[model samples]
Target: MTARDLGLPSRVPAPGLPERVTIWEVGPRDGLQNEDAVVPVEVKLEFLDRLADAGLTTVEATSFVHPKWVPQLADAEELLAGLTPRDGVRYPVLVPNERGLDRALAAGVRHIAIFASATETFANRNLNRTLDSQMAMFEPVVSRAVAEGLDVRGYVSMCWGDPWEGAVEPGAVVSVGRRLLDMGCSQLSLGDTIGVATAGHVAALVNAFTDAGTPVSALAVHFHDTYGQALANTVEALRHGVTTVDSSAGGLGGCPYAESATGNLATEDLVWCLDGLGVDTGVDLDKLADTSAWMATKLGRPSPSRVVRALRG
Candidate 1:
């Protein structure tokens, strides 16, 4: 059955709900990239251990971006090399180019995520290339990775709307998604980069994407909580059969290109919402809250996650 068949109600029978939803925890990488004070590699390893213990099966451990762009994650190789990966858990990392891909492969990582923005402006600003150039660069990476038996996940930023380019056309997002799938990406994550998307917009865009032969099973939604609409948009996507979600612990990370944009949707918050709706994420909410609070303390800031704050209260 599709997500539409389930409908949106305030309550659902615990036994009558969908079997499960896939949650990709992105705390270790996206959560710490923008911090001014460098987080030690050991601290990063501890954080990852807590995430695994919290019942997360997929965690983005680090990024392979150049140190000049994001110095905080310069220890990507060291970090991934040290983690004692759990049996059921999958550890993935972000790779920006061929060199980054090589680094991850050397560390024996099986999952890798590549990024490109739907808007030309964001692509140029973040990736130093136009949309066409970014796609061209991804071709060889995707091809080689597939040959190596690695799973490739594609991220299309600003899928909902862009700060500079204004409301992005649905067609533009779908076109990029198609290209990524054609390049052999096993999954496509639609990123609401600036958190400007609404529930209606999410449904419309998801419907369009699924209708265009971009298999719904291969789609995941990634939203920022900048406008307090991340959860709502996620619900809309779930209703349309988009089961995979990309969220960060403690609501960490924001797009540098999208000025003043806040954190990605908090994993703690998403877990709470899903648990209440009878959706099983295999995540321990209390443990997730504890980890989020610990990271917030390390950063010397309050958590951006409302659920974490409420639970602590």
Candidate 2:
């Protein structure tokens, strides 16, 4: 039986949230990125197939960063080569720099994402670049990608509190995001890299972006659940007109570079929340939960997503 069959939540339909939201499934890449042992490429491929069968349209496939850094995803090329390109689904990969962009393009990737840091410390620690230099690095990558007729997404990490620098100013995030968009990014995913954000900060950040001429329609929220606030922050973003939310299946994955960061907002959790709110997520909650449960088995751990546990346990 489906989650709706069990009456997960009575529909309430929040007033200001968007009628439809595009959920960016980051399970394959973000969810499995930090795993200790390299998962077999076959299992990763099966995970992608399951997610597709479950109806998530925008599944982030993998990152092309050097395997030395993210060894778990070293099979990026093989995975893409084996991927069955489902009709109507978009598989976006993370491209770190020019070299990463080359790999993505060679793989025939039509959508790519570049990650930037909202704080200088994070830029140095995660990207080995100073904050100001981030633009110079991403400019060529984004510009070339867009010129190739590819959809480029910019991920602004540490949008709320930085682990080293503490609270990040909303204006700083907008400045970084505006430059990315100006350079060629069609969308920006503002990430609470350490999951320290609250609902108020989420609302303020989205408002700040809009006030700076960045439309909410072009923004997405990526929150980690370290503070038990990812779901709450997502609702706040939705209330402020943001239509895209990033989540991982089974509550897997955290920032490998950020010690304090925890697992992302789980896809099942977000789907359950949106289902109750009467927002059209276009996700099959039952099938999605099953996919998470199956992946948990593959990982030899229990699923971290609450909805998945409640439904599949």
Candidate 3:
């Protein structure tokens, strides 16, 4: 059965849905890092291989943060070394600071991500610094990475409502997003870290950035399903001309700092939606779902993705 045969809409008459959408798979890094059990490096490699084979063009392979912070991905170096890079695939690793960037460069990484929080409280809790201080720390790292000819992506977390701050203003998100782009990030991924954003909030936020002179083309949306709003928020983003969307295979990530946070918007779920909408993701739905189901076994659980469950059944 094809996506069209499944009765999914190929394109909404609405203006924002693009002819093609880029799905940035974050299963390896964001998904596994939050797991209680440590995933072996070999398994990580296999997971990434399957994702690429399943048609994921961009995969967030790992994070180069200190093991004390994300022990599950402490084997970032070994994982990258073992990964067989496929043609037309880009692997990006998360780097929190200069130290993390140095480690990634030593591993021969050419793509990196730097993350910042939109709210002051989450910034202090997650990065151990205020917003200004955190951005200050990232300046040199982003600058150096750009100088090295690396593709850098900046993440603005807690873009909507913050667990500590209640409500986040769109202006605050735009400010940090603009700074990250100015610091040499090729793209800015606005993250709903706690998943409190609604479709309305998403549209407002994306427009705010665009109105502030940041092109929607340079933006991506990273949503969590904590409140079952990730897909809705993603649709809003798509309607706003944002072409990139971030998801974890099998809905496999949560913020360790945000106790209320849940798994990321599942890649399977996103693909299913995109397929139905007749949007081009370049991902094979069955193959993607099978990959998630397979990874779920490695994690010793059923995938949290609704599409995976429905397809498997």
Candidate 4:
């Protein structure tokens, strides 16, 4: 029987959730970048098209990082060139530095995201810059992107815990996030990179940001599913008035630098929760699951998403 026939996830509106949540879909870029085999440029373009069709308004398209580091997404230029931009959908690309910003400008990208590490050990290992020096790297990129009239979003990774530096402080996350907002970024996405965050920690961290003067409107949560807390943590964030959430289709992503990191909370999974809560995200769940299933076939494996397996079975 179909999910519809099964009457799965009965709608019962949650009391404190946002009336409508903005889902920041990161499948094409963050999802495919970690794959062992390179996905063809044509396939990438079609993937974007399918995501937009599935009603993902802000689909992260690709990264402009150096190919030497992330070879899988080396076809960023080709993919952008072939992309058929949708009328209402936004395609945001990841820009790593000034050079990447230059490439983004050349490709006519209107929105971009710059990543930062929340802890010192992660900063040194992932960014090759000390915790404080990393801002120097992102400052110019954010400044230039803002000057060009492009929207910039900042990502603070390792928000909850780090492999080398266990138990990240909420104040430290707020410190990094506030600086990014100070740097002209329109929004900041706090990442649970290793997926160690629980609901209580999530509440405390969101409270810290608001307590320190950052509004919930300017914050987004990106939770990894490594420890199975992604969905529960997402609910906690929603309860605290966080409207923007970052999720990947089919749970297809991981951090290359952090071996403990796992795939993002599945976009299908997020949609199911939101759908049941009567929170509007504008994503069609069945279509999204179908897209993830098709993507899984391309990778020669079953999808890791429980919702996808349940619905597609």
Candidate 5:
């Protein structure tokens, strides 16, 4: 059935309209990046293919970080080289620096994502550098990628709270977001790395960025389910005109630096929420649940996505 058939709302009636929420599935990269058991290259490729087949247009394909840091994705080059390119899907890789950008270029990556943090402590812990240093490094990488005809996406982590520092200021998020946008990033994804944000916080941040002259259309929200608020926060973001969300299949991720936080909002769960709200996601809920379940079996762990478990019954 189409979204209209599902009795979901197509558009909000306010002066601002959140046309459609774009779901960028990150199961292949953020979901599996920290798994203790290394997933095989073929398996990763198959998982990505399944996501594409399920109608995901944007997928975070992989990361080009150091193999020593994340050995699970040590086969980044081989995986990128072997992916069967789909006609309309955009597969973007995460590049932490110029070295990663060079590798992505050599491997024919057409889109790349860079990450920065809002807090100095979280920035140092996650990226091993101060916020300014991280921005300085990514500025040229973003420019070079854009010059080469690649779409650049920038992720600003710890928009809500930081593990080392508490209560990240909204202005801090805006500062990094503006720099990323000015540096030639096509989109800026604000991430609640530790998942401490509430719906109120979500609305506040989205408005803060918009009021600062960054278009709401250029901003996306990424939330962890640590506090069970990702979905609620996503709804708040949509109401405020932020239309893009970053999610992982099976809810399969957690911050390496943030203790006890779970994955981003599950893609299946997000699809279900949007479907119920009459929002068009263009994703098949049952197929996504099946894929997440199959991956859970392969990993010998319970699928973290709530919709997946509920649908399996």
Candidate 6:
């Protein structure tokens, strides 16, 4: 039987959910970066094409980080060069520093993302700097990108909980988020890097950001499904006025730096929830599920997305 046959509600019973939500698909970069085997550039390109065809408007194409760090996505330049840019589709690449920005700029990228951690331990481990220093490092990159008319997104990792530090205070996330916004990022994506957040935790963090004078509209949520709370947390964020969400196709991401973190909230799963709520995401659920299932073949594993698995069954 199909999902529709299951008699799911066409719209959510709860009020206050946005009529439309923007989903930023991060499978191409974050999803593939931690893979044990190298995915050929051609396969990566095809995966991107399928994702775009599945109706994702904002697809993070690749990261311009050092090849040594993320060898799976070493072909960022080639991937960007080979893409057939679609009208109304935005492709953003991750840029670690001015050097990565230079590479992205050279590759003709128009949108880039810079990431910082809310906790000191994650900051030191991931960026090899303190929280303050990491913010300082991204300042120049954000400034240069804005000056060049490139869309910039800032990611604050470990927004809810940290592996070493445990139970992160929302205030610390707010401070880093405010700095990133002040640095000229068009949007800030709050990440539950270890997927330890519950719905209540999600609500508190969103409220904290708004209480600190940061517009909820400028914020996005990026959650991992480790504790099985990603969808619940996403619903809480949406109810709290956050309209942008970051997800991966086939649930294909895990933070390499934070080894305990699991796969990201799947694009298919998110789309299914939104579709049932009568929320518009401009994404075709069946197409996305099929695309992910196809990618599973390339990755030599079954897709982790429940929606994809159900559709395939």
TM-score of every candidate: 0.94, 0.98, 0.96, 0.98, 0.94, 0.97
Q: Tens digit of lDDT per residue, candidate 5, span 1-313?
A: 6432443334334434355678999899999988899998998999999898888999888999999988888999989888998899999999999999999999999999998888898788888999899888998899899999999999989899987778888999999889999999999999998899999989999889989988988999899999899999998899898889999998998776677567878998898888767677888777888789989988888998877777763
lDDT of each: 0.88, 0.93, 0.91, 0.94, 0.87, 0.92
lDDT of 4 at 292: 93
Q: Write the per-residue lDDT of candidate 6 for residues 65-118, one digit (tens) a residue.
A: 998999988888888888989888899999999999999899999999998999
Model 4 RMSD vs true structure:
1.0
Candidate with better lDDT, 1 vs 6 = 6
lDDT score, candidate 1, position 282: 92
Residue-wise C-alpha lDDT for candidate 3, range 1-313, written one tens digit per residue: 8433453335544445887899999989888889898988889999999999999999999999899988998898899989999999999999999999999889999999998999999999999999899989999999999999999999999999898899899999999999999989999999999899999999999999989999989999999998899999998899889999999999999888899889999998898788767688999887888898888888898999988887774
For candidate 6, which ten residues in a row score worst on lDDT?
4-13
Give candidate 3 regions above 4 Å deviation.
1-16
Cα RMSD (angstroms) for every candidate in the order listed: 5.1, 1.5, 2.1, 1.0, 3.2, 1.5
Q: How far out, in Å, is residue 212 in model 1?
A: 0.8
Worst 10 residues of 3 by lDDT: 3-12
Give the alpha carbon lDDT tens digit for every residue of 17-52 in model 2.
889999999989999999997899999999999998
Model 2: ten consecutive residues of lowest lDDT: 1-10
Backbone clashes in model 6, listed as residue pairs: none
**Cα RMSD of predicted structure 6:** 1.5
lDDT assessment of candidate 5: 0.87
Clashing pairs in 5: 8-278, 9-278
Could you give candidate 1's per-residue lDDT for residues 148-185 as a string of tens digits? 99999999999988888899989999999999999999
Runs in model 1 lying further than 4 Å from the true structure: 1-11, 14-17
